[model samples]
Every structure is written in structure tokens, then in C-alpha cells.
Target: MTALDSFAPAWQIAEAVKSGTVRAEDVTRDALDRIKSLNPKVNAFTDVTAERALTEARRVDAERDAGKKLGPLAGAPIAAKNLFDIAGVTTRAGSKINRDLPAAAEDAELLKRLHAAGAVLLGALNMGEYAYDFTGENAHDGACRNPHDTTRMAGGSSSGSGSAVAAGLAPLTLGSDTNGSIRVPSSFCGVFGLKPTYGRLTRHGTFPFCDSLDHLGPLARSVRDLALSYDVMQGPDPRDHACADRPADPTFETLTDGVAGIKIARLGGFFSTDGMPEAASAVQSVAKALDTTGTVEVEGVEAGRAAAFIITNCESARLHLPNLKTRPDDFDPDTRDRFLAGALLPASWYIRALQVRHWYRENFAKLFQDVDVLLAPATPFPAPLIGQRTIEIRGEEILTRPNIGLFTQPISAIGLPVCTVPVFNSGMPIAVQVISAPWREDLCLRVAAHLESEGIVAAQPPSHL
Candidate 1:
């Protein structure tokens, strides 16, 4: 196999393995070797399940040899955020406090689905503490550095998901987005990430952040990989009350349907403000490539963002209240203070936030009447320096962490499906969010695939990879 094959998209790798052009064992070992060599530099993985991966790969090879049909993602190497429950590993969720919990008795529902589909699990990856971060800097596991430039952040709380995929250590990884975790990291690290509508995927055996707005999705080098993984993981789970009971909405079959007649519009107003030139350029590039000249304004976006923050703070704070009341020192200072403050918020404020969320969701849903997809910047900028505390956006200095999700929070607050397409500029990568109405991940993926095919957006391996 050529060196380039190691960095190929997961779908390509799977086809090779299924056709017997490459042994699943060899592919898994090569991926594990890459992780060993490159992970130290990016600090993407907190744990490496090399033995388990090789064992799974061997099973795939044996299955093929026995003339049994393999799954669509057969033999693909993938990983998950540390928040996922691996059978025998502690689900750290990027926190020191959770290290003492007993290992999960069974794998997370998504992991089990991937395994059944023939994907090998490389291991659990590093993440922001308790999913409350956007900078991808974890106090316990060290920051997940961007593969494109190790000096910059990978974007968090799905930091390792972005880094691993961009660095080619693994072709696919799963991440959870509470506000903008998946999209921010994908933008900063240069990869395709999908945040499906809230509750579209099962959350059983995964750590929680904000129950109301939390979502689980895939991050990969290609939109096809995202679609494949998403297709394999979709199903109704009684264990997760929030999981939708609707029929599976398979996206891979329709991913290449082109956006020819799809009505696409750029998000104006708040989305166009407080962002760097690169951010706007990324969105404009996608708009121009798709021949979309229409711009739509969703009013009350700022208020929606505010409501999202209030809801996230209150929900996350409540979830961690027991630990905050005891063993507070174990929590990361950045996370601890936020939780403490949230714990003190008035109940009436949370109620008001919920009301605002409903109002905003209603208004945002109405825009789909004339638009199939909405384009917006994924992050305010590509990525700040690893430890940089402040960023200048349009001449206004702002704290880097919370403001990084400026454009993303408003949309995710309403639980819309969004696909982030990486648009490269001067060797660095920023991304544009192709968003659609609730449960329309196919629309988002369709738009992203068209941009990718047109060469307007794509994932490029970092120099070292």
C-alpha cells in the first residue's frame, strides 16, 4: 500500500479491505502505528486501544475469508471522544473527577453500532473538561494541538476528534456537540463534521452536557465517511428517551444529488458581524460556488445565543452539582467557576431561556419555507494560539473561549442539522456551516458534498501527515 493510502478517506479504506486488496489487520496496524508516532505531537488521544483494534480487524478479515458479507464500514479505523463509554475504560469526559468511576459495563450504543458495521475502534480521544469548552484545551489531558500547525488550538470540546482526523491517525471519529463543539474543532482542524439534529442519534452510554441541545455526530476527512458513519449509527433506542423514533434517514444514497435547484442562502446580520475576514471568506466561497446570491436574516439570533448559554449553564451546572458541592477542587478551574455561577442562577431565568428557545426555534424553522440550506461561518476565526486568551474580531477584542461559538450557538440552540465544510485559505482551513431545518441532515450533507466535489471545500492532511 502507498503512504497516501493511510490518509485516504474511510470509505476508500473500507472498499479496499472489503475487496481483499488490503488486509484489515494491516490497515489497523498502520493506523495504530500512525497514532503512536503522531499522537504525542497533537495529544489527540488520551487512551490508545491498539490491542482491541487489532483484534477487531482480525475478526473482519476472518469474516471475509469465511465468505460472509461485511458491513459497509467494514475494517475502517475510527475513534470516539473520551465521553463515550467503552466497555472496559473509564469514560473520563475530559475530567479528572470521572477517572475514578467504574469502567463501563458495555460500549456506548453508537460504538456497538459501528462495531456491528465492521469499523474498528482505535480508542477514546481527549476532549474539553465535561464538554464545557471551545478552545480544545483540557486541564487534565493537555491541549489537542491542531495538526495543520501545532502552535494553534484544535478547537474544542471535540478537540481530539478534529486533530485525529486531520492528522490522519484515524479516518473517522465521533464527537458530541452541546453548542458548537463538533463544528468549531472541524473548522479549526480542517475536516468535515456533521452535527445532526438533536436526538437524531442515541445518547445512551455517553456523558451528558446539556440535555436540551446536546447532539452526537461524526467528524471525518470526507463527507461520504460522515454519511456512512451516520447511516450505520441511526436507530431508535428506548434507553435514550430523547432519541427519535422515526425511520432511518439514510444520507449516503443521496449525498451526491448536487445542490442544483436547492435554494441556499447566506445568513446575514449577526452571522456576518464579529468575524474575521477568513470566516466571511469561507462562507462567501461556498455561496459563490453554489451560485447562491440570496441572503436571509433570522432575527433574534443574539437573543437565541444568550438563551442557549443560559440553558447550557443551568443544565450542565445541575448535572454536576453534586460534584461541585463536594470535591470541587478536582474540577478544572475554568469549568468549576462556570458551573458554580450557573448553580446560582435563578430558576426563573432558566424558564425564560426555555421560552426564548421555543420562540427562536419557531422563527428559525420558518426560514426553511424558502431556503433548503443556510450558509454561515463555523467559527469566528480559524484557530487561536493554543493558550491565547483573547482574540480581535472586527476591531473588538473579545474573550476567545465563549465567543468562538458566536455563529454556531444560535443555530444549534434550535436543534438544526448542520454540516461543516472546510474551506482552505492560504494553507490554513476555516469552514462554512451548511445548515438545514430539523431532521434534514440529507440537505446539509448534499450541499456539503457538492461544495467538496466542486473543490470549493475539502480536507487536506497536515504537513506532517
Candidate 2:
């Protein structure tokens, strides 16, 4: 089958399916066929749920024929990072060790919600093992290459999530952000991604990475799709202790509320683009488009990033201690080495990290009181060449893996909502983070939508693809 206009936005696809202008099954088949054809080039999908997707699509058609009302995301194809449980599929979590685990008995809570909202499950996407990576190179599954330039990284641990959407295999995908997984991939692959406020989304059926810092969200081609996915997959879940017992506050309905009067500020100080010309240009372009000149210094941002690192290392190390003890050789060498180091860290470091988290959250709370939204670079630079270990910043060479999250970690550490908007300024695309106060994801998306409206940012199809 010829591919569905893979470049078409999710909202358009859903509207067509809902109006009977197209059949859901055909859309599913087109997506599956596209995955079969393009996935080898991109290496995005680890598993393709052809049979399951067709079945779901047919059900959607049947419901339409029966005059049953469909949900907001009617007939759009969606996939998740392999970490999310998908019923019979093994929750790989991008690790060789997880391949031996039994298949999940039920779909993840978010997936279930998507299913209810008429999203067909396309399959699972690749990621950095155990969600510990910034680059998309997975030792077990090979790298998920950037769609724009196959030679570059796709950004990860949500690597495949970003690649699939950019490559047009799927319109929307679910990914978890422990540090900058969603935002990094969004920046690198030139797509829109949201790392909703931590705990705003449930982690019940997804694999645990950094228990305290982990957050689940969607990456899409359009800001509205992000709002649609966010609206549906919310609400408290008993299975996840961190899931907030809050009402489902819908953002899609209120999305068109423009950012005219909203106070916006560019984050300065630690977020300055001292070494990354591409990142700096992207931010400046966005500031020009938004017509904002005001800048504010965020105190303790560097320290907050440090706390995020310590907390992530300790929590992930403890979670995988049993496997690290037994199947260390089976694990990816890079991930194993970090896990081992985390295992040896003193307990006091983790405690101090938690204390820092509280302090940082308080600091951001005060900052938000002055501005409704904050702007900053999502990643230090664009996608680096795959297998490139070090990047030059400020005339100093630093490891690429850890430093990619330099701008993102501090905001994520405080569990604030963020939407990374892709800005195409040079050969490769970079992005700017639109951050809002806790529980104010609506503000993040609103600012992102405004930028998109002004033609400053977009998820344009890659020329190479």
C-alpha cells in the first residue's frame, strides 16, 4: 500500500478517519507497510504490531459504522518506547536482560487510555538501555539513526520515539523522560515533544528508570496532538504511587488561548549558550519570533543539574542491583559501567541529592511567580555523529552522553512541565524548551503553539527521508 501522507499531522489523520473520508484499517496498513519499508533505514521500531494494529483499526471502523462516538484521537497511529508494557510484548526497556522477562499481561495505563481514545498501537520503539542514555546508540539493538541525517544520532533514551515520528512511521509516540530523553530526541530529530510535570502522568505499567525523576509523555508533529494525548492519558492511577490524585484537567479545549498577555522570560545564567552556537542561534531566533527581550537568571541551575545526576545514578543503580550482580556481562557495557559506579556511591550522596531537589523546586516556584513561561535551549547542540564520544564546548572536551542534558536537567529535576519546540536554523535541527510552572503544561504548549504559528518552529519533513 502506498503510505498515508506520512507528513500529515495527527489531527488531520484523525479527522479524516472520524469523518469516514478514510478507513482506519487502511491507515493502519499504510503505517505498518511504511514501518516495514523505512524502519531499516531509521531503526526506530523494535517490534511491529501488524496484527494487533489491524484488529484495533477494524474495531474503530466497526464502532463508526455502529454510530458510536469515537474519542479525540480517532484512528491515529501511536507507539511507545519499549519500556512501556504492551500486553503480550516483552517490556524490553532497551536492555538485553529484559528480553528474558515474561511478556506483559496488560497494556500500560497510558496505552490503555490511548486505545480508548481510538489510537492504534503501531508497535514499540528502541531506546537507550534502561533509559540511561542521551544518544540513541543502543549496544544491543544498534543505533536509532536521525531521520534528517542517517549518520547522526537520534537522541535518547527515547531515541526510536523521535525517529519514528520524524520518519513518518507514526504520528505520535509515548516516551519517558528521566533527564532529557524526550526533549533531546525532539531537538535532534526536529519534532515536538513534551515532558509533562513529573507525576502528572502515571508510571504504573512502564519500566522504572529513575523512580523519583522519571516522567512519561508524548512526542508529536504538532502541539495540539501533544495536548490531545496529554488530556486523555491523565488522571490518578492506584498502581503508580507517584501518580497524582488530581482531576483530568483538559488542555486541548483551552489550547487556542494565545500567549499575548502571558509573561515570558528567557532563562539566562547557567542556561547561557557560551559554547553552542547552534543552540544559541535557535534560542535567539525564537526570542525574536516571540518578540521578547527580557532575560532572567535562574540561581542554582548548575547545582540542580548536579543533584539530578546523583539522584538518577543512585536510584537506577539500586533498581538494577540484582541484575548488575548476576548478568552484568549481558548488559550494555556503557550502561553497565555507569550502573556499577552508581552502585558504589555513598548513601549520603543520594540523600544530599534529594535535599537539593527540594531546594531547586522551591527556587523554580518563586521564579514562576514572576513569569508564566521560561525559554531555554533543550540540548546543548544538535544531534552529534553516531559513535562520537566527545563534543567541544568552551574549548573543553566533554563526554557527549551526560552533557546533552545540561540545559534540560535542572528544569526536569524540579518536576516542572516542559515542551521542547524544534527550531531549524542550520543543517541539523535544534530546539528550545518552553517551560511552565508545575501543573501548567497548558502554558508550555500555548507558547509552543504561538511559536509554531509565527513559523519560527516546525517538525518539517527531513529532506533525506
Position 170, candidate 1: lDDT: 94
Poorest lDDT segment (10 consecutive residues) of candidate 2? 1-10
For candidate 2, what's the RMSD?
A: 1.1
lDDT of 2 at 435: 92
Model 2 stretches astray by more than 4 angstroms: 1-4
Model 1 TM-score, all chains together: 0.98
Candidate 2 residue-wise lDDT, 116-168, digit = tens: 99999999999999999999999999999999999999999999999999999
For residues 250-274, could you state the per-residue lDDT of candidate 1 as single tens digits? Answer: 9999987888788899999888844
Candidate 2 residue 44 Cα shift, in angstroms, is 0.2
RMSD of 1: 1.1
